[model samples]
Target: MHRMPTLSLPMYDINHQATLGLTSALTTLLQQRGVPAEVSWPQDLLPHWRDDQLLLSQTCGYPLVELLPDVQLVGTFLSSAQGCDGQRYRSWLVVRSADENLTLSDFRGRRAVCNSNDSHSGFNSLRYVIAPLAQDGKFFSATRFSGSHRQSLAALRAGEADIAAIDCITWALLRRNFPQELAGLEIIGETPLCAALPLITSAKTGAATLEKLRSALSELTSEKRYQDLLAESLISGFNVSDRAFYDEVREWKDRAAALGVTAL
Candidate 1:
């Protein structure tokens, strides 16, 4: 008997309950279709994407574009959240609510936080928005890398940073699950909409397996049990996607580099 393939949905694994619920739902759906999928969480996700057993996973647009040569594009998630429109989503530039008097220009020479240098919505998108405003390829007085969107928000809330860009889907999920975390933050600006996160598979994965995975994802909305899980996960549905869809992220990177603004 052949070994079953593996799945991982780490992008939105914010908490124990949410992650487990989503994993269980996905596992059951794939298994029902005779795919024999198992949910496996890795401490570091980048390495796992290259694993031979990787059947399906999700990754941000920035990394997706960077890894296009190594990974196969499967689909993109659609969210009912405000900044999301089908496969496209944007980021909210947030600051403390008390900083209502602050404007984008005022952010100059102030501390800024970013989730990661490699993130589209969290870092690259923000750099693109600030590129025009940047002077000498510099904007913030000091920039900090928080490593994750949640940590970036935490930095702002704790007064360690003046502003940060957060993915709209993550912002929506926090609003639903932990409203208090956002009580003190306000969205002062938004970036242009780009392709949202994409579902990925190893480049070596056969087309037949990819089709089975896509079919399983499409069935989520119609299945009652999975519908509830989708609601909890803030995932409305998935749309068929291809590598070309992520070219915009590459453009963002190129534009940022052209402007000499590469991080924060």
Candidate 2:
């Protein structure tokens, strides 16, 4: 007898509280339908990728596209509260107390820190905002790539850097989790709205299977028990979204190429 396929889903630590609940809910939902898919957090999912398993990775716009270039996205998901009003994702460029008096233009000649080049909120989204202001050889006098948003924020907080771009979603989460760390800084400006993170599957997955996955996601949070699980994880909801939403990121890539920040 042929075995039903298993699905693995990995998400970052910012949503660690929600990952297990999400994984279990997905696993149960798929199993009830005889699909036999398993969902899990990133660390759990990463080690099991070699066995022809289906993966459901949750990531922000930049890393999702960069980290799993081989995978085909099934759909994009965003919390109700995290959705923005336009193409530009709503994010902020936060700076330490010492730089509170500086303007956006003043970012030049200062050291700027970011989480990773693969981070949309950390890098790509902000790149679109900063590229326009760059001309000649002038932009940020120096740039540093921290590994995570928390690290980037800490760098600024400790005076190791002058400014960093932080997504509003993570910003709100951090505020709720660590108020004291944020008290020493202020948001200087908002970047363009960006596409939220998405749910992706490997290219080997079938179109019919992808449709079923989308349906499963649409219904995942509707049950009361699942809703409670989401609440504990700080997830509001995952709305149906598509790739066109990410075209703005491609636009940023163009801008990145134009401005010589081409490594993205």
Candidate 3:
């Protein structure tokens, strides 16, 4: 006998309203197939990602390639967010809108912030954008992790950091949920478009259950009934994928490293 674990939509859970809307639809879809599902928010996703009971969740590309090799890749979402196209997404290098006249090079020796080193959109994409401009393995005067993308935006707003790289999907969500946070920020540049977040489930899931999970995602995007819900979540479509589809993300990291730079 097999039991399905809770469904966790943790990555872009920035807005509770949106998260709830999505959770409701997904739960209904899964339940229709006799997959008992409920939303659970794990404070630390690393351990939860590896748990044998993990049913389905979205994770960034960095972790998919570097960690959690055993986690099954479910699929990738085709986000309708501003910086997304097809199955690819990019980052916006943000600074105060007051710096409109300043270019990327103008911020030399200034501070930068990101969500985490493990985050693909926040740190990896950001590092790839500036690795070419680095000197002696250094780019910013100081670099720090602000914990989350919204915090990084707030840091720029509060004058704590000169610039930060934020995922464009997050940028759109903040615009809808908390527009004031971005009131005075502008995108100085856009990073290279790489793979979007990979949806994953536990490797311990039976093949029959795995297909159900994948089918739920596939129908979520293709069906007209969920179109409105998808629009609300900034998801335009969904693409079937495996771990090999995320090789581009790791390539970005390798390209950055080849520049003789480490961190940003």
In candidate 3, stretches whose alpha carbon ends up further than 4 angstroms from where it belongs are 1-4
Model 1 worst lDDT run, 10 consecutive residues:
220-229
Candidate 3, clashing residue pairs? Answer: none
TM-score per candidate, in order?
0.94, 0.83, 0.96
Clashes of 3: 0
- Per-residue alpha-carbon lDDT of candidate 1 for residues 1-264, written as tens digits (9 for 90 to 100): 766677988888765687788777777877887778778888787888777778888888888777546888889878888888888999998999988667888899999999888789888898998888888899889989998989999999999999999999889888888888887899998999999988898887888888988888888765676776787777888889888888999999889889888766
RMSD to true structure for each model, in Å: 1.8, 3.5, 1.6
lDDT (tens digit, per residue) of candidate 2 on 1-264: 654455655443455656666777887776665556754434433334333465455656665544555566766545533435432347788998777878778887688889877778877766677776777635787778987888888889888889888877678667766677687999888886767666777667777777777777768856666777666545665666666666676777787668866532
Regions of model 2 farther than 4 Å from truth:
1-12, 39-52, 63-69, 82-88, 259-264
Query: By lDDT, who's the top model here?
Result: 3
Where is model 2 poorest over a 10-residue stretch in terms of lDDT?
42-51
The TM-score of predicted model 2 comes to 0.83
Please write out the lDDT profile of model 3 over residues 1-264, one tens digit for every residue: 665587888988878777888878888888988888768889999998998988888899999999989999988999888889899999988999889778888888999999999999999988887888888777889998998999999899999998998999999988988899899999888897899999899898889988998888888889998887788779988888878889998988898899977678
Question: What is candidate 1's TM-score against the reference?
Answer: 0.94
